[model samples]
Target: MDPDRPLIPAELNRYARPDVLIEKGRLRFLELNISTRLGGDAVARWLADAYIGLCPESGLRRPPSTVAARCEALNRMRHAGNGHGGTGRLLIPIHSVIDVSGARQRRDRIQPVIVAGAQRLGFEVFQADLADLSLDAAGRLLVSDVPLDVVLLRWYGSDRIIDDGGGLAALCAADRAGTVGLFPRPESALVSSKAVLSWLREDCDAGVLGPADRALVRDHIPWTVCLGLDGDPEVERNLLRMAAAERDQLVAKPAVGQSSNEVIFGNQMSAQYWQSAVADAARESPLVLQRRVESGRITMPFRDRESGQRVTTRVPFVLSLFMVDRAAAGVLARHMTPDLPDGDVVIGMRHGARPNAVLLAPAS
Candidate 1:
């Protein structure tokens, strides 16, 4: 389903990489990243050898790299609307001053890995902040004096991208002149909305999906609804009824948001607090309430270098799939404390948690 409007206004639409949840042998579609920028390639590169060595007996294999596909996607976008293509000089833009929120603070941690991976895949890669990006007199996008053929934008979200007016203007100018490419065409942001899950559920309920599709939807898609946005009395009444009735079974999320910011799991709060949260969510951004599903745990090996010992622990984790050029590229496993079943590994990384590259093997 198309969003009412694009998250960031633009001319083209492409792919959206979504975050999904699996519980009790079922898949649950979660929110999406319009930018679709996961530092997976970098992480996989960092962990590839170590993981393979550690799991040699398990027949662990390297997950496919996304560098080539991403480069090609940008190249395709560069030539799609305008007949312009060349040896891709890709520039990845990151925030110079890290946000106070402490999410994706510096590309320094991930940029070098991406650079190495991209270089291996045969692309000229550069990293810069908005301050260093500009449009030259001839309308070419330049990063620190070097003209960029494609930009692998990691500005975080579409909202953040829109707020970078000067940089966005320069980028847009370059795009208009067919001098540069954007990995994700801005219109693709439309697919990132959690609202789409509701539409999918509606279609499922309406019997629009055939048996195979209906089974997939029923097994994977949670019951999600956009509440209090329209201010219709009947809609609001029904929302409150369902929300109150299933307080412990619900999870509330911002309709258009990222980084798991301000997500409220109903089971964790009091009835009074949940009501207030639902009210406040409606007042700010339209909110979606989905049935919460508990995630299972996985056994992971952790080695203590100082002690020169290895131990295995069962940790709660969420598996994320990375896609490039519309194909499965790799898998990422984020471990979290068992207490916080829905905890975000990215957020946990700030405090200290390591992300793992998942090697998928057939069932024995």
Candidate 2:
């Protein structure tokens, strides 16, 4: 049943909340979604507007539209003047064929936020992508050839596309040794799955992603069978131990998947699905089953379309909350469409309404 206003905004909306910071000043809005990023130079022109607005010295040779052109424009603008950073600025790009597509636009959810945010914070703004990002037509390698200061790993909930950031973290050691700042942390990545509950078993956690979800991880053995042999016996024991110490019958997630790729009831997953190939199966790739996730019942509180009463039932749309560096960034309640299964509601993250970073609640 569809509600007039999505629960995303209703339960916990950053914009509607009271904690966001607002300096009395002028503000502008720009989007950088999948389609817009593919729009070639037009997107670049949009970025130029931001750069020029920030720094006037950035002389305009011509409005650029391509990646290289936009990079050039931004360079001229930021570096030409005194430049904002003590360290020289850098630019990087990631090419991906599996970027956001269809009715959902990437920009609508977020913009060139990293660059813009960093530039504002006095750090030299830079961009980079894997050598080959199937998402962009320029499918060529972005920063494979260049040395990088940061390995910006992308972590969306799923991995439907080639460049959806499935194996990005493993590469962090090889490429960037200094700082591998993921968009969200490892905590955010694993929380979506039953693994979260297991993780907290030794640590002590709370929420909907509670002990049940924990039991699915380590310290729990009778619950799991040895399917495809776990490499290290210790690793296996640790996993089972973690599971036993935690909760059970929870949603197992692809370590790196998005929206609703392999979203299934925990009972459906096989042992093979749990190991090395979790991302593959979760993303509908060629990989076989990993490990099983615990599954029982899922009931959510939803408002009936006709009756004003809030009913507890199950529907595809699940409540999701996002954070920027651990700060409550935004919230969205999405309808389950085919691809996304959980298509998002109005997606927005206002600065003022965000929660305090100091006050954090573990995944529930």
Candidate 3:
């Protein structure tokens, strides 16, 4: 590690996945996934397994595939005990509240796939919402009466987990007693906020980084300023003024947000709307005004669900790079239209920009 680099919280070391974009021979990092509740671990493993099974030859080139690597990491954690007995029983904590019907569907389809993988690796797996779990007076965490060894968090965010007094208190008690293990170690959420990224951006300009580190931050992170919180009020005020004047060159993002919620793009809206959004964003919640990077548009073929034929369409794509313990793990390529920045995957499965499995070609 470079001494000049910004000090990443010790908690983020457990899992440091960064969302990055590779364009024009430059790698731009958007944000870090420090929270353990992050999704897509299951998806990444599933995709890798499916791809390797479909084309065994590719596996020969990319040795010790992503899934294999992840399993090794999990097994290591299980064996470490980390104050708990290495019983090899892992619990995946989900959101306590959800539409019962949708939750059932996820239990039936989404979770079983990941459970199967865990079981194959010599581990007992249990899935339950956080509410279903209990920490007894003895500080033993249990799910349906079974003692848990480690927690593979699947909940989306930490705010809910931390706010659930019973759950939060139990987890903290167990953590202090060293009775159970949490993959992300809980403190990772502190750095997960976009506000931390803004601070990092400031560090770049302050010459806190070495020459090479400075170049990386300058080339990757967008110029960002945290608003509605700590920082030079004058600087933030100037940034807001500039955003209003040059509406097409900037975007305002929530400092603590997820899944593209309340992301206001200046280029796509009217001046009045953009200005209004900036004001509301700054006032409602801490926000970061980021210089917008135009996405790269490319054409790719997909098998149309209805037509049952391959169709080629042009869309803006983002390369989502996954990292585990600071090591590269997987890459997911997602594409969307200019109008829909984050893609429309949730509204309609086939309608939104979707990710495709990476296929490797034979070496020349």
Q: TM-score per candidate, in order?
A: 0.77, 0.33, 0.77
Off by more than 4 A, model 3: 1-8, 34-67, 98-110, 128-138, 143-146, 156-168, 302-311, 337-351, 360-364
What TM-score should be assigned to candidate 2? Answer: 0.33
Task: Report the lDDT tens digits of candidate 3 across residue range 151-195.
Answer: 775443433332243665565566666677776554555566788
Over the stretch 81-129, how does candidate 2's per-residue lDDT look in tens digits? 3212313344333444434443322312224654554455454544544
lDDT of each: 0.66, 0.32, 0.64
Best candidate, lDDT? 1
Following a full C-alpha superposition, what root-mean-square deviation does model 3 have from the true structure? 5.7
- Model 3's lDDT to the true fold? 0.64
Candidate 2 ranges with C-alpha deviation above 4 Å: 1-92, 97-110, 128-151, 155-193, 202-257, 265-317, 336-364
User: What is the C-alpha local distance difference test score of candidate 2?
Assistant: 0.32
Cα displacement (Å) at residue 230, model 3: 2.7
Ranking of models by lDDT: 1, 3, 2
